[model samples]
Target chain A: MSEEKRIKVLLAKLGVEVHWRGVITVAGMLRDAGMEVVYIGNAFPPEIIETAIQEGVDVIGVSTLGGNHLTLGGELLELAKQKGVKDSMVFVIGGVFPPYDIPKLKDVGFDGIFGPGATQEEIVGFIKDAVSKKLGK
Target chain B: MSEEKTTKQILQEAEEKRKAERVPLYNPEALKQIKEKFDQWYNTKLREEDRKNWFVTPQTILGSEIPRGLLYTPLDVADLDYMQDIGFSGDEPYTRGIHPNMYRGRLFTVRQLAGFGGPEDTNERIKFLLAHGATGINIVFDLPTIQMYDSDDPMARGQVGWCGVAMDTVKDWEILFDGIPIDKISVSLVTHYPTNTAILFAMYLVMAERRGIPWDKLIGTVQNDIIMEEVVRSGAEYLPPKWVFKNQCDNIEFIRKNVPRWNFITYNGYNLREAGTSGVTEMAVAFTNAIDTLKELTGRGHDVDWICERLAFFWDPSMDFFEEVCRLRAARRLWYKIMKHQFNAKSPRSMWMRCHVQTSGISLTREEPLNNIVRAAYEALAAVLGGAQSMHVDSYDEAYSVPTEAAALVSVRTQQIIQAETGVTEVVDPLGGSFYVEWLTNEIEGRILDEIDEMQRLGGIVKVIETGWIHKKIADYAYKEQRKIEEGIIKIAGLNYFRAADVKLPEIDVFRYPEGVEERQRKKLQKIREERDNKEVQARLDELTRAARRGEPIIEYCIECARAMCTEGEMFKALKEAWGTWRPPAYW
Candidate 1:
């Protein structure tokens, strides 16, 4: 009956993404909700997954506003699967995403899709609920 | 002749008259009596419970949180002196407006920011807008070009032409302006940072030069700013702050002497304000940056008047209509003072606070996306009343994606309606004499000056960026504002409130970005690499390397490299090898 996990999460911007105010705001929001959030500046997709594995985080949030979601985002999830942590971790994507891209992102193995206007409370609640059920709390 | 006094006596009389014009607007005794009467009116007529401690503000940014008064009077602006503080528009210390007739003299230039996909695609859009009556041109490059990566580089994968135009070589510039008039209209290149400006702006120059346009007749602006890279723009490789500042001054030096009609730099306060800084902080940081830049140029033995006249500013006109109007008036006055007292600038043009403004994209909401149209209209109106030399109204769909042609046309219509039908611009600074506007103008001016003083005390803009002090300030501001929005302390119209509306986004189409842009750009770069004279490119790169190492100006070498069809990435690598690279400090 112990549901006291800190809900560790890792966040990073895709390469050369300049509109990172969204990532900073989300990282702060998660940290405010008592989540252990590790934020690394813009990195390559493989390096980001490697850091997530090394840090043993429960979620990977990749933010990119540069309209590269189809290719780069697909590669991000493919790397997660190749590294054998695809099922263990909940992958999420955020930032300037069109609503139509939601289905495609889900197809690429993104467990959650947060675009513009997604509230902080909604995100923190979603991640909390997903992580707790995974922990069997 | 006998009635005329001696020259000494005439000089003393003129000085005395000038001192007389500096008198205060209201006497202390009169103001005190009015204050007592206002309190009496308030206690009897106003309800006690109706008076709340909190205030609703037009903008939630810093310098905007305060108590509001139910009434404003002459007593509120008792300290204002009309002749000394604010005067007629187009006069010295041009607080009211830069031109005496304001819009009667000329309407504000409608510079819509349009770029996304490959160079030819954006070029077609530019021609369409021009045929449709847009007065000015504003070009924003894509993430790869803005970050100084070639279209073929792995770092540029999938992002070549997403955010803006993909420009790799001088050939791309040629394609971009293939049919456009170069000398007739003014172009604003959103080239942020020294290295990017050094590369892309050089391409623009080479393109125009190859077309045989005389350099002296060219008219446009390049955003050769350092703070935009160091503090505002996030997540990219940057040249070190010291070296970045040096290159910015070097651009000013070259442009002032060569392309004399073009504005070399528009110190970017717009990006700062949109990045969660207060309106006052935005002006303060921009003025401070200008002060430091002018100093660097003067140290190189250029007079203040020579290079400072073509310098310009870019500001963000936020939702606080009166506050922003006052900020602009106060900014004009303060800049005049700085140029006069600090730099002893001789030319009046050097003292003019010429600025191009844009509506705040952050202030637009994602919920009920159409609500953004009304919001942007109000912000555009504010920019007009504030006397922005040129302005771009953000489209409603900007909160979601790049604007469709329909959305962009609506933005142009927004500006058109304001300029033609509203009749708002018939008068210059019509709100100049309002008690609240005058009082707030003086108050915001003082606060901006105080911020400038604080920055100067703390080792100026470069040192503060190195230490990440400014970064922490902005982050804290953004975080607090977000918390307010989440707590419902600051309610967005359809988002945090009015939840009953059907917030369906299908009402408008999210712009379908042209497909295969990245592929086309990659192929173009590959062709240029194969076809262009590689030996000539290498010779120019070597000269860039040698010039960068000796700490000599590199813009000349960059121009030569552009002449040889050298790619932006090739020249940037040479400079990076010499001047070094920087990673921003992690303030969070």
Candidate 2:
């Protein structure tokens, strides 16, 4: 109980979207960085929240490329609030999000927002620090 | 004469044997001299000098790990047959081009994939581009349409009109091409899957029929390939490869018989390549699919020549400049060989490898977006130099959304500038005789053949797909490429490397979907249900179900349903009931 546990990250792809290389690459990088990662594919907002609660994952990463960020990301946050998992988990969203959508997604309650051209070190480091803070490490 | 063998007689017999075996392009003695010279140069310049460790292994941008030599010369292509291999353009084994005078005869069609918001919005963009001198029309459907979900479906929420036109019924198809001179302006419907192609393309056909346009008079292409549905663009509920191929063949069978001028199927190497396979694997997969299509079509009692005459290819020309050029060249030559030698196809037109090229969108970066313009231009130039029949240049802003209007115009103008200003199209295959190109062309052909053999060994490409082997292979290559980029082995400007801080990136406008698109589309679907012959549509749906169960081509039934105002989802649902849905092997 006194020691830190390996950060459990759950990566969920929103909707039946294609062009998922970004998410898959992130998953691999996280796994290699000694994180327990469960990738649930083609999920909706409610399912993603339910899975996070069930899996008790420290971080919830939602990747979408279908330009449904504002709509679906907001829906995920709304559902996470109703499910009351908003504080227990860290949320990050990455995809083909434009520069303008960054502040909007941040306002939608995502802790981390990544657009295209995000590096492995940046994403990984951000997740590690966020998860550590969530665990009060 | 051989019994009393004079030296000349013996030499003549040896020459005859060599002729049967197809001797090298250069004399053996000459090649030996060239090899010695090459070795001498390599030794003196590198090994003998202080830069002894200067030899760096060369690889492609996509990293098939196909080694590249320092230089290619006549020695590399010593065995190439001039008359047999690099024949004149329009001849057998068309390494030069399908047409002798390529662009000089008919300039390549400049088409951009345009669709977003509603059908009317896309129609307006198509008109704008055409007014700006775009030669043809190409349209893409929104996620719901491509995924075969109606606008009102729960799974389709938040996605309607998000990226492409929100098409659901024949009404959308009708509105999409409202006044665009259908017969004259060749339209490419990116109906990316067999199931969707059957519905969307059927709606298109019905619309044309309503307008009194004969299907035979229309010219366009339908993306009716099986790989897109089963492999490249996979979903959990896609129909199994076994039945999906049937839907694909049915569409092609009907199209070849009815719309003879239209390309029935474009074996989409673009989607497959964009899924993150190497450039070489792209051709291997496409030609493999084409070979399977040829077999299935011929098995349906269609003549091989008739089936192949309108067959086409779609390629994603990435940043591998020379390899992209060589790949297209090798693909053309290999296709001709497969037609002539393997299938015994009779018509020369049937053997032609007509392809459309779109510069690789996966190669674009969101950071410092202007660099993408140069990347796209060079890729487009590769396609043009490689002799694509039609071309599309990816916009610099595509990493974000379906390109904005300004970006779309730039893409169209990119092709125009290539066609008008570059002067690269004046002659056919100017790189045809270059030592590097010819040597790489032959090398790529051999490697591609080896790859095809590998596919055959794995029980053919179709079995490979049905077994989920292709997905695994793609993932492996994709991961490898990602690692390469991450490790700085492959330098993507403004992304992995060259993060030039001093260069000011211009503020680019991103495309936004029109408001209430989903509401408007749903209203139209509701209105159609209220207005159309509902009983007739249900009856046609039953016909479609029976057609699917009876192993008949369902395109006819789909056309009937489209004419009856049935929606794409209705047809898709009917087929799902008849043929059943399938889940692919979970790689994650």
lDDT, candidate 1, residue B90? Answer: 86
Count clashing residue pairs in model 1. 0
Cα deviation at B507, candidate 1, in Å, is 3.1
lDDT of 2 by residue, A17-80 (tens): 7666778778888898888999887788988998899998999998888877888889999999
lDDT of 2 at B436: 86
The residue-level lDDT of candidate 2 at B423 comes to 93
Chain B TM-scores, listed for every candidate in order, come to 0.94, 0.94
**Model 1 C-alpha lDDT per residue in residues B1-588, reported as the tens digit of each score:** 345342223324544667756778788898999999987976787777545522345435333553445567998787677877788888877889888899999999999997989999999999988988899989999988888889889899978888899999999999998888889888888998877888888889999999999888789999999888788887557789998889999988988899999999999999887777788889989988998898788888999999887989999987777788888998998888787666778998898899999888987776788888888898889878888899998999887788889899999999999999999989889888999888788788877878887777777789888999888888888888888877877667887777646666655688888989989988998888899889999999999999998988889899999999999889889988987888888888
Alpha-carbon lDDT, every model: 0.85, 0.83
Give me the candidate number with maximum DockQ. 1
Candidate 2 lDDT over residue span B1-588, tens digit each: 124332223324544555776745788888899899877887776654434434344444564565666666887788788777788988877999999898999999998888888898988989898999998988888887898988877788888897788888878887888889989989999998888898888999999998899999899998988889988864547787888887788888889889889888999989888877987888898887787777778876878998888889999998878888888899898888777666678999988999999998888987788788999999999888888999889999988777888998899888889889989999999999899899888878877777776676676656888888888788778777877878888888777676776645357898876789989988998999999999999999999999999988888999999999998889989999898877777664
> Across the candidates, what are chain A's individual TM-scores?
0.93, 0.94
TM-score of each: 0.95, 0.94
Cα-based lDDT at residue B292, candidate 1: 86
Q: Any runs in candidate 2 off by more than 4 Å, and if so which?
A: A1-4, B1-23, B47-60, B234-236, B501-506
- Candidate 2 displacement at residue A66 in angstroms: 0.7
**DockQ category of candidate 2:** medium
